[model samples]
Target: MQSSSSYPEAVEQLIAGFRRLPGVGARTAERLALAVLRWTPEELHDFGLLLATLPERVGECRVCGNLAEDDLCPVCRDPARDQSIICVVENADQVPVIERSGGHRGLYHVLGGRIVPLDGIGPEDLRIGELRARLDSGEVRELVLATGSDIEGEATATYLARELRRPGLAITRIATGIPVGADLAFADSATLATALNSRRPVG
Candidate 1:
Protein backbone atom coordinates (compact mmCIF):
# COMPACT_ATOMS: atom_id res chain seq x y z
CA MET A 1 0.00 0.00 0.00
CA GLN A 2 1.33 3.37 -1.02
CA SER A 3 1.33 6.19 1.54
CA SER A 4 -0.90 9.22 0.98
CA SER A 5 0.80 12.50 0.04
CA SER A 6 -0.13 14.05 3.39
CA TYR A 7 1.48 11.17 5.36
CA PRO A 8 5.23 11.27 5.98
CA GLU A 9 7.53 8.19 5.91
CA ALA A 10 7.44 8.01 9.74
CA VAL A 11 3.63 8.05 9.69
CA GLU A 12 3.62 5.32 7.04
CA GLN A 13 5.89 3.20 9.21
CA LEU A 14 3.44 3.58 12.11
CA ILE A 15 0.55 2.60 9.86
CA ALA A 16 2.47 -0.49 8.72
CA GLY A 17 3.07 -1.42 12.35
CA PHE A 18 -0.64 -1.19 13.06
CA ARG A 19 -1.33 -3.32 9.98
CA ARG A 20 0.58 -6.16 11.59
CA LEU A 21 -2.17 -6.53 14.19
CA PRO A 22 -4.69 -9.34 13.70
CA GLY A 23 -7.63 -8.62 11.33
CA VAL A 24 -6.17 -5.17 10.52
CA GLY A 25 -5.82 -4.42 6.83
CA ALA A 26 -4.01 -1.53 5.18
CA ARG A 27 -7.10 0.72 5.16
CA THR A 28 -7.90 0.05 8.83
CA ALA A 29 -4.26 0.63 9.71
CA GLU A 30 -4.32 4.00 7.98
CA ARG A 31 -7.49 4.94 9.86
CA LEU A 32 -5.90 4.00 13.18
CA ALA A 33 -2.74 5.94 12.36
CA LEU A 34 -4.76 9.00 11.39
CA ALA A 35 -6.73 8.76 14.62
CA VAL A 36 -3.49 8.64 16.59
CA LEU A 37 -2.09 11.57 14.61
CA ARG A 38 -5.15 13.59 15.59
CA TRP A 39 -4.53 13.04 19.28
CA THR A 40 -2.86 15.75 21.38
CA PRO A 41 0.92 15.37 21.61
CA GLU A 42 0.70 14.59 25.32
CA GLU A 43 -1.93 11.87 24.79
CA LEU A 44 0.04 10.31 21.96
CA HIS A 45 3.25 10.37 23.97
CA ASP A 46 1.56 8.78 26.98
CA PHE A 47 -0.01 6.09 24.79
CA GLY A 48 3.35 5.29 23.21
CA LEU A 49 4.98 5.02 26.61
CA LEU A 50 2.21 2.72 27.87
CA LEU A 51 2.66 0.44 24.86
CA ALA A 52 6.44 0.40 25.33
CA THR A 53 6.16 -0.61 28.96
CA LEU A 54 3.48 -3.30 28.56
CA PRO A 55 5.84 -6.21 27.94
CA GLU A 56 7.93 -5.50 31.00
CA ARG A 57 5.03 -4.51 33.25
CA VAL A 58 2.83 -7.56 32.68
CA GLY A 59 3.62 -11.29 33.02
CA GLU A 60 1.95 -14.64 33.62
CA CYS A 61 0.95 -15.72 37.08
CA ARG A 62 3.52 -18.10 38.58
CA VAL A 63 0.87 -20.55 39.77
CA CYS A 64 -2.06 -20.32 37.33
CA GLY A 65 -0.29 -19.03 34.18
CA ASN A 66 -2.85 -16.20 33.81
CA LEU A 67 -1.80 -12.67 32.85
CA ALA A 68 -0.61 -11.03 36.03
CA GLU A 69 0.72 -7.68 37.19
CA ASP A 70 2.32 -9.31 40.20
CA ASP A 71 3.77 -12.70 41.16
CA LEU A 72 0.29 -14.26 41.18
CA CYS A 73 -3.06 -13.23 39.69
CA PRO A 74 -5.91 -12.07 41.96
CA VAL A 75 -7.84 -15.32 41.56
CA CYS A 76 -4.86 -17.43 42.53
CA ARG A 77 -4.10 -15.30 45.58
CA ASP A 78 -7.65 -14.70 46.80
CA PRO A 79 -8.42 -16.54 50.03
CA ALA A 80 -12.15 -16.52 49.32
CA ARG A 81 -11.70 -18.63 46.17
CA ASP A 82 -11.97 -22.39 46.50
CA GLN A 83 -8.57 -23.95 45.91
CA SER A 84 -9.84 -27.52 46.04
CA ILE A 85 -11.62 -27.09 42.72
CA ILE A 86 -9.71 -25.82 39.68
CA CYS A 87 -11.20 -24.70 36.35
CA VAL A 88 -8.79 -25.25 33.48
CA VAL A 89 -9.18 -22.73 30.67
CA GLU A 90 -7.36 -22.25 27.37
CA ASN A 91 -6.53 -18.64 28.15
CA ALA A 92 -6.84 -15.94 30.83
CA ASP A 93 -9.55 -13.96 28.99
CA GLN A 94 -12.10 -16.73 29.61
CA VAL A 95 -11.78 -16.35 33.37
CA PRO A 96 -14.29 -13.49 33.70
CA VAL A 97 -16.96 -15.37 31.72
CA ILE A 98 -16.97 -18.29 34.15
CA GLU A 99 -16.93 -15.88 37.07
CA ARG A 100 -19.94 -14.01 35.67
CA SER A 101 -21.94 -17.23 35.41
CA GLY A 102 -21.79 -17.40 39.24
CA GLY A 103 -21.62 -21.18 38.99
CA HIS A 104 -17.91 -21.67 39.65
CA ARG A 105 -16.16 -20.50 42.80
CA GLY A 106 -12.95 -22.42 42.18
CA LEU A 107 -9.51 -21.17 41.22
CA TYR A 108 -8.28 -21.30 37.60
CA HIS A 109 -5.31 -22.63 35.61
CA VAL A 110 -4.66 -20.96 32.27
CA LEU A 111 -3.20 -23.38 29.72
CA GLY A 112 -1.90 -20.45 27.63
CA GLY A 113 -3.25 -22.29 24.56
CA ARG A 114 -4.65 -25.61 23.42
CA ILE A 115 -2.88 -28.48 21.72
CA VAL A 116 -3.29 -27.78 18.02
CA PRO A 117 -0.91 -29.93 16.04
CA LEU A 118 -1.64 -27.99 12.85
CA ASP A 119 -0.40 -24.82 14.55
CA GLY A 120 2.59 -26.75 16.02
CA ILE A 121 1.31 -26.31 19.60
CA GLY A 122 1.87 -29.39 21.75
CA PRO A 123 0.98 -30.42 25.29
CA GLU A 124 4.51 -29.66 26.50
CA ASP A 125 4.23 -26.09 25.21
CA LEU A 126 1.31 -25.34 27.49
CA ARG A 127 1.19 -25.10 31.30
CA ILE A 128 0.21 -28.75 31.74
CA GLY A 129 3.24 -29.44 33.89
CA GLU A 130 2.19 -26.84 36.43
CA LEU A 131 -1.31 -28.30 36.47
CA ARG A 132 0.11 -31.72 37.20
CA ALA A 133 2.21 -30.28 40.01
CA ARG A 134 -0.88 -28.63 41.49
CA LEU A 135 -2.80 -31.90 41.37
CA ASP A 136 0.10 -33.83 42.84
CA SER A 137 -0.07 -31.59 45.88
CA GLY A 138 -3.27 -33.47 46.80
CA GLU A 139 -5.09 -30.27 47.74
CA VAL A 140 -7.25 -30.25 44.64
CA ARG A 141 -10.33 -32.50 44.66
CA GLU A 142 -11.84 -31.64 41.27
CA LEU A 143 -10.66 -30.36 37.88
CA VAL A 144 -13.22 -28.77 35.55
CA LEU A 145 -11.98 -28.67 31.96
CA ALA A 146 -13.43 -25.47 30.52
CA THR A 147 -11.70 -25.59 27.15
CA GLY A 148 -13.86 -24.72 24.12
CA SER A 149 -15.85 -27.38 22.23
CA ASP A 150 -13.86 -26.97 19.02
CA ILE A 151 -11.64 -29.70 17.60
CA GLU A 152 -8.46 -28.36 19.14
CA GLY A 153 -10.20 -27.62 22.44
CA GLU A 154 -11.60 -31.18 22.55
CA ALA A 155 -8.16 -32.64 21.84
CA THR A 156 -6.63 -30.54 24.61
CA ALA A 157 -9.31 -31.55 27.12
CA THR A 158 -8.93 -35.22 26.25
CA TYR A 159 -5.18 -35.08 26.72
CA LEU A 160 -5.55 -33.34 30.08
CA ALA A 161 -8.18 -35.79 31.29
CA ARG A 162 -5.88 -38.74 30.58
CA GLU A 163 -2.82 -37.03 32.04
CA LEU A 164 -4.53 -35.72 35.21
CA ARG A 165 -6.53 -38.75 36.34
CA ARG A 166 -5.71 -39.86 39.85
CA PRO A 167 -7.23 -41.78 42.75
CA GLY A 168 -8.42 -38.82 44.83
CA LEU A 169 -8.99 -36.29 42.03
CA ALA A 170 -12.23 -36.08 40.03
CA ILE A 171 -11.84 -34.76 36.48
CA THR A 172 -14.73 -33.43 34.39
CA ARG A 173 -15.31 -31.67 31.09
CA ILE A 174 -17.77 -28.80 30.59
CA ALA A 175 -21.04 -29.74 28.83
CA THR A 176 -21.14 -29.01 25.11
CA GLY A 177 -24.04 -28.18 22.68
CA ILE A 178 -23.89 -24.59 23.98
CA PRO A 179 -21.79 -22.89 21.28
CA VAL A 180 -19.64 -25.28 19.34
CA GLY A 181 -16.49 -23.79 17.74
CA ALA A 182 -16.96 -20.58 19.84
CA ASP A 183 -14.92 -19.54 22.83
CA LEU A 184 -16.17 -19.70 26.40
CA ALA A 185 -15.44 -15.96 26.69
CA PHE A 186 -18.17 -15.27 24.12
CA ALA A 187 -20.83 -17.52 25.65
CA ASP A 188 -23.76 -15.82 27.41
CA SER A 189 -24.11 -16.15 31.17
CA ALA A 190 -27.15 -18.45 30.92
CA THR A 191 -25.43 -20.82 28.48
CA LEU A 192 -22.26 -20.84 30.50
CA ALA A 193 -24.25 -21.51 33.69
CA THR A 194 -26.05 -24.44 32.07
CA ALA A 195 -22.79 -25.86 30.73
CA LEU A 196 -21.21 -25.68 34.15
CA ASN A 197 -24.16 -27.37 35.84
CA SER A 198 -24.16 -30.23 33.34
CA ARG A 199 -20.41 -30.95 33.29
CA ARG A 200 -19.71 -34.70 32.87
CA PRO A 201 -17.03 -36.86 34.41
CA VAL A 202 -14.02 -37.28 32.15
CA GLY A 203 -11.81 -40.31 32.44
Candidate 2:
Protein backbone atom coordinates (compact mmCIF):
# COMPACT_ATOMS: atom_id res chain seq x y z
CA MET A 1 0.00 0.00 0.00
CA GLN A 2 1.55 3.28 -1.13
CA SER A 3 0.74 5.81 1.62
CA SER A 4 1.41 8.89 -0.50
CA SER A 5 -1.02 7.79 -3.21
CA SER A 6 -3.94 8.93 -1.06
CA TYR A 7 -2.84 12.58 -1.44
CA PRO A 8 -2.73 14.44 -4.75
CA GLU A 9 0.64 15.21 -6.28
CA ALA A 10 0.22 18.89 -5.47
CA VAL A 11 -0.40 18.14 -1.76
CA GLU A 12 2.72 15.96 -1.61
CA GLN A 13 4.72 18.70 -3.29
CA LEU A 14 3.46 21.20 -0.74
CA ILE A 15 4.48 18.86 2.08
CA ALA A 16 7.93 18.50 0.55
CA GLY A 17 8.29 22.26 0.39
CA PHE A 18 7.35 22.61 4.06
CA ARG A 19 9.89 19.90 4.94
CA ARG A 20 12.60 21.99 3.35
CA LEU A 21 12.17 24.63 6.06
CA PRO A 22 14.59 24.45 9.00
CA GLY A 23 13.55 22.15 11.90
CA VAL A 24 10.42 21.00 10.03
CA GLY A 25 10.13 17.21 9.92
CA ALA A 26 8.11 15.03 7.54
CA ARG A 27 5.14 14.66 9.94
CA THR A 28 5.12 18.37 10.71
CA ALA A 29 5.36 19.14 7.01
CA GLU A 30 2.38 16.95 6.25
CA ARG A 31 0.39 18.69 9.02
CA LEU A 32 1.37 22.10 7.73
CA ALA A 33 0.25 21.12 4.20
CA LEU A 34 -3.11 19.95 5.58
CA ALA A 35 -3.52 23.20 7.52
CA VAL A 36 -2.77 25.25 4.44
CA LEU A 37 -5.27 23.22 2.48
CA ARG A 38 -7.92 24.21 5.00
CA TRP A 39 -7.21 27.94 4.57
CA THR A 40 -9.57 30.10 2.46
CA PRO A 41 -8.52 30.64 -1.14
CA GLU A 42 -8.00 34.34 -0.46
CA GLU A 43 -5.67 33.59 2.47
CA LEU A 44 -3.76 31.07 0.36
CA HIS A 45 -3.48 33.58 -2.46
CA ASP A 46 -2.15 36.24 -0.06
CA PHE A 47 0.44 33.78 1.26
CA GLY A 48 1.55 32.94 -2.25
CA LEU A 49 1.91 36.62 -3.06
CA LEU A 50 3.95 37.19 0.11
CA LEU A 51 6.30 34.33 -0.81
CA ALA A 52 6.62 35.49 -4.43
CA THR A 53 7.47 39.05 -3.47
CA LEU A 54 9.85 38.19 -0.61
CA PRO A 55 13.08 37.90 -2.60
CA GLU A 56 12.48 41.17 -4.47
CA ARG A 57 11.35 43.08 -1.39
CA VAL A 58 14.11 41.83 0.90
CA GLY A 59 17.69 42.92 0.17
CA GLU A 60 20.95 42.96 2.12
CA CYS A 61 22.04 46.20 3.76
CA ARG A 62 25.08 47.46 1.87
CA VAL A 63 26.75 48.77 5.03
CA CYS A 64 26.35 45.84 7.44
CA GLY A 65 25.19 42.90 5.31
CA ASN A 66 21.96 42.56 7.32
CA LEU A 67 18.58 42.04 5.67
CA ALA A 68 16.87 45.26 4.65
CA GLU A 69 14.32 46.66 2.25
CA ASP A 70 16.60 49.51 1.22
CA ASP A 71 20.27 50.52 1.34
CA LEU A 72 20.59 50.47 5.15
CA CYS A 73 19.02 48.31 7.82
CA PRO A 74 16.90 49.94 10.56
CA VAL A 75 19.82 49.71 13.01
CA CYS A 76 22.14 51.55 10.63
CA ARG A 77 19.48 54.19 9.93
CA ASP A 78 18.48 54.85 13.53
CA PRO A 79 19.80 58.16 14.83
CA ALA A 80 19.44 57.28 18.53
CA ARG A 81 21.37 54.01 18.34
CA ASP A 82 24.91 54.04 19.78
CA GLN A 83 27.24 54.29 16.80
CA SER A 84 30.28 54.12 19.09
CA ILE A 85 29.75 50.39 19.67
CA ILE A 86 29.23 47.62 17.14
CA CYS A 87 27.97 44.13 17.88
CA VAL A 88 29.25 41.57 15.40
CA VAL A 89 27.09 38.51 14.78
CA GLU A 90 27.39 35.52 12.48
CA ASN A 91 23.91 35.77 10.96
CA ALA A 92 21.23 38.42 10.49
CA ASP A 93 18.80 36.43 12.62
CA GLN A 94 21.09 36.64 15.66
CA VAL A 95 20.64 40.41 15.69
CA PRO A 96 17.07 40.09 16.92
CA VAL A 97 18.10 37.53 19.54
CA ILE A 98 20.47 40.08 21.08
CA GLU A 99 18.02 42.93 20.63
CA ARG A 100 15.25 41.13 22.52
CA SER A 101 17.68 40.71 25.43
CA GLY A 102 17.79 44.52 25.75
CA GLY A 103 21.40 44.38 26.84
CA HIS A 104 22.93 46.00 23.76
CA ARG A 105 22.24 49.54 22.57
CA GLY A 106 24.73 49.78 19.72
CA LEU A 107 24.86 49.08 16.01
CA TYR A 108 25.31 45.69 14.31
CA HIS A 109 27.55 44.06 11.70
CA VAL A 110 26.34 40.76 10.31
CA LEU A 111 29.20 38.54 9.15
CA GLY A 112 26.92 36.54 6.79
CA GLY A 113 28.71 33.46 8.18
CA ARG A 114 31.56 32.23 10.38
CA ILE A 115 34.96 30.97 9.21
CA VAL A 116 34.82 27.24 8.55
CA PRO A 117 38.10 25.80 7.29
CA LEU A 118 36.84 22.36 6.29
CA ASP A 119 33.92 23.96 4.45
CA GLY A 120 36.35 26.27 2.58
CA ILE A 121 34.87 29.43 4.12
CA GLY A 122 37.37 32.06 5.29
CA PRO A 123 37.54 35.65 6.58
CA GLU A 124 37.78 36.97 3.02
CA ASP A 125 34.50 35.22 2.21
CA LEU A 126 32.75 37.25 4.98
CA ARG A 127 31.94 40.96 5.36
CA ILE A 128 35.23 41.71 7.16
CA GLY A 129 36.32 44.46 4.77
CA GLU A 130 33.08 46.33 5.29
CA LEU A 131 33.45 46.01 9.07
CA ARG A 132 37.04 47.24 8.91
CA ALA A 133 35.99 50.24 6.85
CA ARG A 134 33.33 51.10 9.42
CA LEU A 135 35.88 50.83 12.23
CA ASP A 136 38.46 52.88 10.34
CA SER A 137 36.03 55.80 10.22
CA GLY A 138 37.03 56.48 13.89
CA GLU A 139 33.38 56.60 15.05
CA VAL A 140 33.30 53.12 16.56
CA ARG A 141 34.92 52.79 19.99
CA GLU A 142 34.12 49.16 20.83
CA LEU A 143 33.22 45.85 19.17
CA VAL A 144 31.29 43.00 20.83
CA LEU A 145 31.76 39.58 19.28
CA ALA A 146 28.41 37.78 19.53
CA THR A 147 29.20 34.90 17.23
CA GLY A 148 28.23 31.38 18.31
CA SER A 149 30.47 29.40 20.66
CA ASP A 150 31.27 26.79 18.02
CA ILE A 151 34.73 26.16 16.60
CA GLU A 152 34.05 28.18 13.46
CA GLY A 153 32.73 31.06 15.55
CA GLU A 154 35.83 30.90 17.78
CA ALA A 155 38.17 30.96 14.79
CA THR A 156 36.30 33.88 13.22
CA ALA A 157 36.42 35.85 16.49
CA THR A 158 40.15 35.18 16.95
CA TYR A 159 40.92 36.28 13.39
CA LEU A 160 38.81 39.43 13.78
CA ALA A 161 40.48 40.29 17.11
CA ARG A 162 43.91 40.18 15.52
CA GLU A 163 42.92 42.05 12.38
CA LEU A 164 40.80 44.72 14.07
CA ARG A 165 43.17 45.64 16.92
CA ARG A 166 43.40 49.41 16.85
CA PRO A 167 44.71 51.96 19.38
CA GLY A 168 41.33 53.43 20.35
CA LEU A 169 39.09 50.43 19.70
CA ALA A 170 38.23 47.86 22.37
CA ILE A 171 37.36 44.30 21.33
CA THR A 172 35.35 41.93 23.53
CA ARG A 173 33.61 38.56 23.26
CA ILE A 174 30.33 37.56 24.89
CA ALA A 175 31.19 35.63 28.04
CA THR A 176 30.07 32.10 29.01
CA GLY A 177 26.37 31.28 29.49
CA ILE A 178 25.81 30.39 25.87
CA PRO A 179 27.21 26.87 25.96
CA VAL A 180 29.96 25.72 23.63
CA GLY A 181 28.82 24.42 20.23
CA ALA A 182 25.57 26.41 20.60
CA ASP A 183 24.43 29.11 18.19
CA LEU A 184 23.42 32.55 19.45
CA ALA A 185 20.08 32.18 17.65
CA PHE A 186 18.97 29.53 20.20
CA ALA A 187 20.14 31.31 23.34
CA ASP A 188 17.36 32.70 25.58
CA SER A 189 16.95 36.38 26.23
CA ALA A 190 18.16 36.19 29.85
CA THR A 191 21.15 34.05 28.95
CA LEU A 192 22.04 36.34 26.10
CA ALA A 193 21.76 39.34 28.40
CA THR A 194 24.07 37.74 30.92
CA ALA A 195 26.57 36.95 28.20
CA LEU A 196 26.50 40.50 26.92
CA ASN A 197 26.78 41.99 30.40
CA SER A 198 29.83 39.88 31.17
CA ARG A 199 31.67 40.22 27.88
CA ARG A 200 35.48 40.14 28.29
CA PRO A 201 38.28 41.53 26.20
CA VAL A 202 39.50 39.37 23.32
CA GLY A 203 43.24 38.76 23.19
Regions of model 2 farther than 4 Å from truth? 1-3, 180-182
Q: Where in model 1 is the C-alpha error above 4 Å?
A: 2-5, 23-27, 117-121, 178-182
Residue by residue across 1-203, what tens digits does model 1's lDDT show? 76555788999888989999978998899999999888999998999899999999899999998889899998888999998999999888888888899889999999988998988999999999999999989899999999989888898899999988999899999999556433566789988898898999998
C-alpha lDDT (0 to 100) for residue 83 of candidate 1: 85
TM-score of each: 0.84, 0.92
Give per-residue CA lDDT, model 2, range 21-103, as digits (tens). Answer: 99998888888999999999999999999999999999999888888999999988999999999999988988888899999
lDDT of 1: 0.89
The number of clashing residue pairs in each candidate reads: 0, 0
